[model samples]
Target: MSATDLTSAAEGHGTGSSVGTTDLIDVEATDFMPDDSVAGAAADLPAADVAVRAQQLTKRYGNLLAVNQLDLVVPRGSVFGLIGPNGAGKSTTFAMMASLLRPTSGRIIVMGADPSKKPRTVRRRMGYMPDNLGVYDNLRVDEYIEFFAASYGIHRSEWTALVDGLLELVDLSVKRSAMVNSLSRGMKQRLSLARALVHDPELLILDEPASGLDPRARVELRELLKTLNGMGKTIVISSHILAELEEMCTDIAIMEAGKLLAAGPPREILERLGGARTVKVRFATGISETFTVADDAEQAALLRRLLVDEGRDVVEFVEHSGGLEQLFMTITEGVVQ
Candidate 1:
């Protein structure tokens, strides 16, 4: 049960660079422009580290409540996961945060500006990739990216260099001249992501980004997101696939039937929901022991006592953990309103 042995034993774990703008890019501050609306609202951001906050956020459709009295806060420079079963109001909440839908009652503050009040400011600061992304089949990859960069009001002088850099970031540089329709599902998904980043927004609201991707594609997407996060972008992602989120997210929020069931780091939510995790200890003699613990500290302390106090020859000490899936099930009733 030595530290090195424990490190080798606990192997049940699951899963950064900057690009400089070259002189060939040759862009002044004015060369890289945002929309007029964005420019006007950019100066009005309140000084705050809270990237997004929802106060009693609710949305109703006639007699049906899509989201009910939900409160959420997302900090800057974090990869956040928003998860729920079908009809759990995740999409509704995302819509409100993205300024695509108005709330029935409540407020959404994104990047220190209320999206409803100053949507322009939020738009300039946030990049949203919906679950169902549309692609212009006729447009080439570079053309598609250029279209969005221009829509964000990037000046003509910077479009070529900007689009090129974004394509490289998404691993689509070689496909730049390829037609959008000619690409596979995975390639198209990556292209959509490149489109989202064209604006150089600080926050990315991504819905089901890995929906139909193959295993390799999903891994690639996850790595790309991590790179973006390393470069200081706060990303809010939603997906039905719990395991994927469990691996990539820094924090998560769960919802059921339009109500937030839990929100926080995965471990905190798991503990709050009374989720129990087990520790598996194997001795050199082929004997094993299992102990259930409420938290990591407890598990660590137990291991120490077993090794030091009892002088046990521990060969393996694996944390048979309860992850995000366990916490999601523990907190949600699976009822769809």
Candidate 2:
């Protein structure tokens, strides 16, 4: 459970639902396309049922370009992950998407409302949790969520059940009366998550929501998010923990030095980046064989023939696909903007 051992963490934690790699790339390329046309390199991709679309989205701080004409589209009802190295414009992108920071140039369509033109409209439909979330030390967990809910303009009549349900959803129901500062880091992280869900927004923009949590806490967080997604909430999350995102995210966008390296489902990105799948054949004679194949169908066909026609004593046949971290390394050169 070492905080730095994210590789092992990714392997240990599993999503509640099974995510198949087959046709994932094509699905992302087609279904997750932007709703409107984008300028620059992203102009060619088609549009679909997008929850958020950024067309030539850019942000510049003086001379530094924090986000460079980034074209991104998150499909509705998806758990989308935004991944990158340090200073990879992830935070900046989140800010613009949440309508917190003004983009120097470009358009951001959040749930069909332009954040720049209709900030209030977009704000009502989205809930944002920054990486450095601050808590009121004196306020109790229930009070904290209540404060935000009120601020979001929720009716007082619905407060009781709304707060209770959100607390239970994040596994903080027992800590409702506890002071925010008295809670552990994991509890506080969950509390922040509850705070974001207070308004019942259509989209949740989370910046490193699991940043300070331990391994076990991270698993709990993942399960909670899966439940939320199953309830029809669209989530856009950014984290250094690639493995967790690899399992939880339906699709991903990889950025480096304020530039996009790739965007799509992990399997699609891996396939396009020349990532090969591994086939392991274990024989009954205590011997095993492994093959790296480009085409899984062809490999499976050959393996079946050897097992059935040639009468090979095969006990187990397993295929290992490349991981998200591997795909990230291959796509980006780790360059800084």
Candidate 3:
């Protein structure tokens, strides 16, 4: 690909019998700070501080624990991701963060407000696009967006313009007159996203926003998400599709069986999962297991130090972060659920 060409991917699947988890590593608080380029100016940077933070978040149902001491932090103007198989507590986590489910334990701060005690404030600041988006089937697209605008106490005069703008933002302006029920599955998903944006919320909690969409529709929605990020919207999304999330998120968290397995910038996660990068070896004729090293860095490095002979002359010594999928596989042998 060209330098200008960029790609990302999601990292999850529906729950299966056994839960799969990626590797986990501790990140210094410094990891969350904006670098020099990001700290330059408002026109050039997104929000300056943390938009969401979780400390030892936990939740339970009867005797079964739904969420473990999970920790997460999301910065403004970034697309953060959560991935895992079904029953991994991914949806439950989003709900608790959105104030829909009160966690049994742990602390959650969304946009600087505690959802536990001040759900209204948190909800007002957030636009949640849950998996089940029950839009008023009778209302036209424009009317649907307007209805939400009204509920938010927007003035009638401002409603039309805001609705128009939101429609355009979600790329559904052309469908303004169509009945909400008339839109295709993808269109409805986009419309729901539009509804979420109607209030011009600061934070967006999107649970499977791309679920059930055709390829074309999924691409369009991804593009819209990219635009939202460029416009400085802090978004948190959950998806079983690891490829999609990898494409859009700057940072991500991998969950399994109610616990966070890995969380950090993509490269950091990949490194901790087992690879520093990638290493390839070449031999004149062929070398057997002589060159093979364990995935663990310390063990591999120690072997290399002792086993490598100057006579053999290592043909290849390459180092690079492995692909997300490869890293994920190296860390866990089973399905993510």
Candidate 4:
């Protein structure tokens, strides 16, 4: 999508006319001066340690409650994953955090300021990538990126280098002159990500970024996210790809029916939920046995019993823990709202 499309989407266009590009760019040019009273109150809160915090956050679409009283915190410099089945309210929660949607009740702070009350503050410090990407007819990739850089009020003199760097960062340097509409779905996804990074925001909120990506593309995206996190950008991502999230996320939260089911480091949740580990043993006599152990202690005791207590000739002993996928299945009841 072009920068204009992004602006419209970011402002919640379904309820009203889309924000004009001129007005959005003009707003970007001026420094946002927040109300002193609001700023003063925010200053006293503990916002430095966390990038996002929601307390009793709720959102309703008329009679349908999209997000229940949800409470979540995303620590600074962490890759946090939000996972849920369809209708679990992950996207609704993300929209509220990105300041694109207002809550029916409750409050959320992004980068230390209330997003609904201080959207510009939150937006300036954050970048957002939605799941779907809209095509811009006849717009070249470089021009697409430059449009967003201009929208962010970056000086015209810096456009060339900024565009070059961004294209390279997303591995689209070869497609610099390619039309946005001509690019593949994966390429467009990467371009959308580059558009989000134009302003070098400290925080990124991505919803289903790997939806249309191939296996290779997904791996590239994962590595790129890790590189960005290493560079000090806090990322909040939602994906149905549980295995990928298990590999890259430092923390994860599972949601169902607009309510949080579990939240924390993945291993902690696994242990807390009694996610068992599987042990496979092979004997020199060609006998094989499988055992289920709850935790590391049990696995250790099982190994000792095989080698010492039973005095069996253990040829091979391997242990495997059910990662995020198993933990997710164990915790969520396949609930949908």
Q: How would you encode candidate 4's per-residue C-alpha lDDT over 45-106 as one tens digit per residue?
A: 23455677776789998888889877777767779999999999999999999999999997
- Which residues of candidate 2, in runs, are more than 4 Å off? 1-48
How do the residues 222-273 of candidate 1 rate in per-residue lDDT, one tens digit apiece?
9888877776678999998888888888778888888776776665666666
The alpha-carbon deviation from the true structure for residue 327 of candidate 3, after best TM-score superposition, in angstroms, is: 3.1
Angstrom error of the Cα, residue 241, model 4: value is 1.2
- Backbone-clash count (model 3): 21
Better of 2 and 3 by TM-score: 2
Tens-place lDDT per residue, model 2, 295-317, is 76767786978788889998888
Could you tally the backbone clashes for each prediction?
Answer: 0, 0, 21, 0
Write model 3 residue lDDT over 1-337, tens digit each, in one string. Answer: 0101111111111111111111111122223322222112211222235566666788999977878877777766668888776777889889988899998987776776678888887777788999886889998888888888888887788776676666666667689899999989998998888778767676788999988888899998888787666555778998867778887898777777787777766655765565444345555546523333334574467336644744454555544344566655665445433
The lDDT-based order of candidates, best leading, equals 4, 2, 1, 3
Worst 10-residue lDDT window for candidate 3 reads 1-10
Which of 2 and 3 is ahead in lDDT? 2
Residue runs of model 3 more than 4 Å from their true location after superposition:
1-48, 276-322, 332-337
Cα lDDT of model 1 overall? 0.75
lDDT of each: 0.75, 0.77, 0.68, 0.78
TM-score of model 3 (CA atoms): 0.74
Q: How many pairs of residues collide in model 2?
A: 0
Off by over 4 Å in 4: 1-46
